[model samples]
Target: MKTIGYQEVREKLLAGEEIAIVDLREEHIFAQNHPLFASNISLSRLEIEIYNRIPRLDTPIVIYDDGDGRVERAYTKLREYCYSNIAVLDGGVAAWQRDGGELFIDVNSASKAFGEFVEHHKGTPSLSAEELKAKIDAQENIVILDARRFDEYQTMSIPTGMSVPGAELVLRAPSLIKDENTQIIVNCAGRTRSIIGTQSLINANLPHEIFALRNGTIGWTLAGQPLEHGQQRSFSDLDTQIDEQVKQNAAQLAKRAGVKQINFIDLQNLQAQQDKTTYIFDVRTEQEYEAGHLPASRWVAGGQLVQETDHYAAVRGARIVLVDDQLVRAYMTGSWLAQMNWNVYVLADDFAQVLVETGGWKPATPQIDVDLFISPDELQQLSTTQNIVIWDFTTAANYKKGHIPHAQWVLKADVSKLIQQPAFTSLDAIVVTCGSSLLAQYAVPEIKTQLKSGQKVYILKGGNAAWAQAGLPLSQELELLSEEIDRYKRPYEGTDISKKAMQAYLDWEFGLVNQLKNDGTHGFFVI
Candidate 1:
């Protein structure tokens, strides 16, 4: 495979050239340490996720693995799909460190750094957990707005917090506020969303005192404050006048942030340009996007797009177009992207007729050898007599919900480690499954490589979903063979988390700025 040095890649990013620097490791490993802008596209999901993220086959792409020998395999696989311009990082991540390149931990380093930059530059107002708790106890004339996804708010929130996700804060705030005397407090699980949400209201010139719940629910928990569970307070619809005012306010903020507005014609012309890569996103709620959305537009809610930019748009320096019918969501999201130094624009023209999709999108399945797959019926028959081992590659939450009976839960990255276990060493045949069978197919080859000679690997056709459809029994019992650390458990995800875990989470987020300072690779500029 061809190779590119760290300095060259760094220089290219600094120059704002379109390039996709992909870390070919699982999410957990990628989060441990990767270049500031590297997007984690694991080898197992590369084919399934690549087309949506990269789009242009000729776009410059760099793949790296921490000398784990996965980069070459990823390069080979990409070549089979006819990707034109691809290179492996020279000496991988270790070489980058040796050459003084910055390494960032956790996902979405750029977005997180930008959040810090916003607070630093904007000096967004905030209230400590103690202060907020005292206000709540005293019954101060205030409204607590949870500026996260509805589900996240449902998981955990302040005593009387209302759900108004980031982009919706400006649009829905006016209707929810009783009077100018009512103070507004916005919060998220941690810091980024809270800061951005508070700043957004200020930018919109809301005539009320606004403060972010400092450190969010983590702060509340650490302060020995109780968080309410399953709270469902949300904003009602706004009047036409209020909606128009929100649009005007959001537009002003976007203009101040140097966010550009593009008409449909300009967007078409922009997409026609072959020299640059462009990502078109519908930045509305998933429900709205599913009901109807522009053709070729991917669904990423405005808040999540800003919080997880790397996951949605892997190609740095690529042009991004944000679309929404209400105009406020798109402008608000575009404003943040512009401040983060992305070449971002909001669609200015109405394209309501283009709304085409009516249901959830299913990713196109990659072409895999049919022989590698076994029918659900066949697996059921084989399992009766043969000593079959089934590995479920789905998320821990999904595994807990339902999985094929007797399937062992394991991370794809940990499969090699499982080989040393006595239970797996004597397996007669191995079957792999995920929510969908696509990831299972990608994993089959790797599983085969690690197996003893003559040991066979097969994918359960259509995965667990198909097994259920075939009237097969599913076990809700958890059968984990690996530690459940592949994905970080959010302190606010479930109903019951100890105060100790919440404090630890806050400590982790609090240290990220120093980590970024030490790494020094992130090229963030706040406007």
Candidate 2:
């Protein structure tokens, strides 16, 4: 495979050239140490995720692994998929470190770095959780807006905090506030969204004393403040005039951030550019996106799009256009993208009628002809007659929610390790499943390699979703063989997290600024 050195990759990023430096390792391992701009697309999920992320097959991609052999395997797979320009990183993570390259921990490092950059440059105002609690005790006329997702807000929030979410802060906050003199406090589980949300309102010229709850809920816990659980306060609808004003303010903010306003005609022209990669995203809430969205627009909340830009748009230096009905959400999100040094745009037209889908997304399963495949009905019958080991490849959270009655949750990266367990050794047949069966289908080939000669492996056609659709009984019992560390647990995700964990999370975020300074590769700017 063709290989590129660390210096060339660093230079390309600094020069703003389009490239996708993909780390071909599992999510948990990739989080330990990776280049500032590198996105983790694991070898197992490469085929399933790459096309949607990179878009342009010809976009230059540099794959790397930390002394592991995954990069070569990933390169071979990319070639089979017809990716035109692919290369291996010359010496992987070790070489990157030797070349004075910065290593960032955690997923979505760019967004985190940008938050620090904003705080550094703009001196984004913040109130310590202790100070905020004192204000609360004093019965201060303040509105605490939780800028996390509705679910996250429901999980845990500061007392009396309302769920305004990310981009909605700009579009909905004005309606939620009646007194111009009222103090406005924005927060998330941690720092990034809180800082961005507070700054968004400030940039929009809100007439209030705005401050981010410093370090968010973690800070609150660290300050010995009790959190309210299962809060459900959401924003109400705004008047036409208020919405129009919000749009106007958002446009101005986008302009200041150098975010381009693109018409549908311009978008069409952008889509026609074969050499360049363009990602179109509907940056509305999941409910709104499920109701309707622009054709070919991926549903990513505006807040998440900013918080996890690397996850949504893998191609660095690609053109990104964000879509929303009121224009506020798109502009608010695009502004951050622009500051993060992305070629970003906000759609400047009302094209709501162009929405094509109106339900949950159903990804088309890959057409892999596995030797053994079983229908949901057939599997149900077989379960009654013989022993069959069913493994669900869906996320741990999803598996916990509901799955086939006897299915066990398995991490794709831990499959090899799992096969060594005593329970798996004597299995007669193995059945693999996922949210839709697409991920399961992709996994069958690797799973087959681990099976004994007499043992058979089968893909559950249609997966758990199909079983549920067929009115099959589902189970909520958690039967997990692999630890669920693939996803980082947010301090605000669920209730009952100890103060120690919260403080540790705060400490980790506090150290990120130093990490960014040491890496010096991120081209983040504050406007």
Candidate 2, lDDT over the whole model: 0.83
TM-score of the candidate numbered 2? 0.91
**For each candidate, what is the lDDT?**
0.82, 0.83
Q: Of the candidates shown, which would achieve the greatest lDDT relative to the real structure? A: 2
Off by over 4 Å in 2: 236-243, 350-353, 361-367, 370-373, 400-402, 413-428, 448-456, 468-485, 496-498
Task: Give the per-residue lDDT digits (tens) of candidate 1, residues 1-527.
Answer: 78999889988987888899998887777877788889888875677888888888899999988776677777887887778999989988889889988777767777877787788778989999999989999999999999888888988899999888888787778888878799999999889999999988888888889999998987887788788888777773334235676679889889888888988889889989988888999887788888998777888889889988999899999999998988888888888998877888888776666676677666644576647678899999989978888999888778999998889898776665576567766778899999877776777766666677667788888889999999989998778987665564556456577878777666666666676676554555555
Q: For residues 1-527, write the lDDT of model 2, one tens digit per residue.
A: 89999889888887888999998887878888888888888865776788888778889999987665677777776776778899989888888889888777778888887887788789999999899999999998899999988888888899999988798898877778768778899999989999999999998888789999999988887777899988778884344235676678878888888999888889989999898998999888788888887777888888988998899888888999998877888989988899888889888776765666788554322356676779899999988877788989888889999999889988776675677677766778889999877787776776777777687888888888889889999999888987775566655457678877777666777777788788776777877
Candidate 1 error regions (>4 Å): 236-242, 371-378, 385-387, 413-430, 444-461, 469-471, 476-485, 490-523
| Number of colliding residue pairs in each model | 0, 0
What pairs collide in candidate 2? none
